[model samples]
Target: MVNINEIARLAGVSRTTVSRALNQSGYVSEKARKKITKVIEETGYVPSEQAKSLRLQRTKVIGVVLPKISTETLGRIVEGIDEILSASGYQILLANSSLNKEKEIAQLKLLESRRVDGIILAATNREETLMQTIRELRVPLIAVGQDLPEVSSVIYDDFNAAKTIMKKMISKGYRRIGFIGVEETDQAVGQFRKQAYLDVMNEENIEIQEGWMQQADFNIQSGEASMEAMLQVCSTRPEAVFAVTDRLAVGAMQTIRKRGLRVPEEIGIAGIGASEISRYVTPPLTTIDYQYEEAGRESARLLLEQLESGKKSVKKSVMNYGLLERDSLI
Candidate 1:
């Protein structure tokens, strides 16, 4: 364990000068900084994170809480966040909430206990508990994907994206279009996308079949199960289905294929969240490009602004959505 004193002695400088040079303090001359850095490299000296944090009153660590880490959209968002945070000399602590409210709250508490400088959350719909916990955190907190009334957030315009997709479907002669999503309380999945679907369907005078509307957790298995159940209602088969996410759409497409149905010919499938996998699927799904990476980058930028400004004002950022047309729907 090489200490600052040893580095100072070896570099033929005082401990105070070494500390200033190592910390990159303004008082240290360029020549001294270069000398100290060279000596540090040769000695294989590692600075004490505890001492550094104690002096700065910050850990230089940012916590990112995500609903699920395995999903493609979330993964891309993390990549974007890492790209910015790493360049700014900050490290990220990833915590997976597993879409569980309790787990998310617990993770936030743990991060606070670790004295993280800030936190970024890709929250679930049922995040009241997490939101309340965030209010008490000494460090700054930013929400991503879902907005909190009193907190800063970066999100896509899910409502407009859904409405646009539904409108496109209706214009393409999809008279009986079904909606597949999660619970209504889920702001992104259930409320925004589902409401847009219903509003557009009603406005177009399209009759929604009772069994065609379904909600479930965002998972491929849930999507498959929901679509399977929808297929059982023989009286009314939807001409097209709009899933809230690419995973659900992929699952629905698999069900359609299994039943000897062809996409766009027998049953069209479309969804939100244009993940990379969406483009590689058998039919190359048609989906709304939610720009999750852009959301992540914007969230990072917002948090950095808060950190630099040392202000607690809430900010809201909305990203644009694009539609990707493919073989899943004509």
Candidate 2:
């Protein structure tokens, strides 16, 4: 593609003069305009719509970065975002990081290069490099799932949600409870949720066995492996388990059933993220509903406010959650 720089070089004029000649919005000498026109005619250089939008400083597009694209939770969130953004005549440009920290930062920079009106990131980890990159963005940005410093965020009450579920589990007279979580780099799902479980267990005066707490990745296979490792290493088996995500919980259930254990009878299990498949499992899974769609809508709404008002204002929205009591944790 013949860009304005090439056009400028061919025309013996600056890029700014070429832009001025193309848009006719600024003063351009007749000699320079003729030179640019001759270059355009020779090279067949028609300016792209993206170039025009960049000149005008309005693309009417929002960049959305996700940790993974296949999850139902993220799908619902995108649905909500599209619901609001489409009404405002803005389109979404989606980029998936696939849960890689480096890829997350790279995608953010790529979106910025695209010159989208704004960006909404469903962030996983709050690493310093990622946070610094967010701080340096030239466009308005909103973060989902993690509370980033000085940045507008839409987050779930992860600590309270986990604590509430744990308290309920304790109320059922289950002292030997296990936990499956991700790395603490992810502030919402990993650190806050794990801390809530620890607090609840400490408050109830329950002893957490050495192998009772295990870390796993976001996938079901990792959940199964983590659970199996827990069972192998622990001298005393836990009566129940709390997984940080529904997929992980489902994986744990698979491992338990494979060992001829009955759910909620031999081993009770629950997870966060109220995924659709959680309901249809042989024994329904109990999980927390984080209102994923609502988070998306709210984040979009805030970004629109910044765009419309031409102001970058910092705001924090803590989304509500609910515990769905089901057969798994009965």
Most lDDT-accurate candidate: 2
lDDT of 1 by residue, 26-136 (tens): 365656656666677677685555434434445678999988989889998998888888888789999998988888899999888776789999977645666678888
Model 2, 256-290: lDDT tens digits are 99988989899999999999989999799998999
Superposed Cα deviation of residue 282, candidate 2 (Å)? 1.5
State the C-alpha lDDT per candidate: 0.83, 0.90
Per-residue error at 60 for model 1, in Å? 1.1
Error of 2 at 164 (Å): 0.9
Off by over 4 Å in 1: 1-53
* Candidate 1, position 7, lDDT: 88
Question: In model 2, how large is the Cα lDDT of residue 218?
Answer: 94
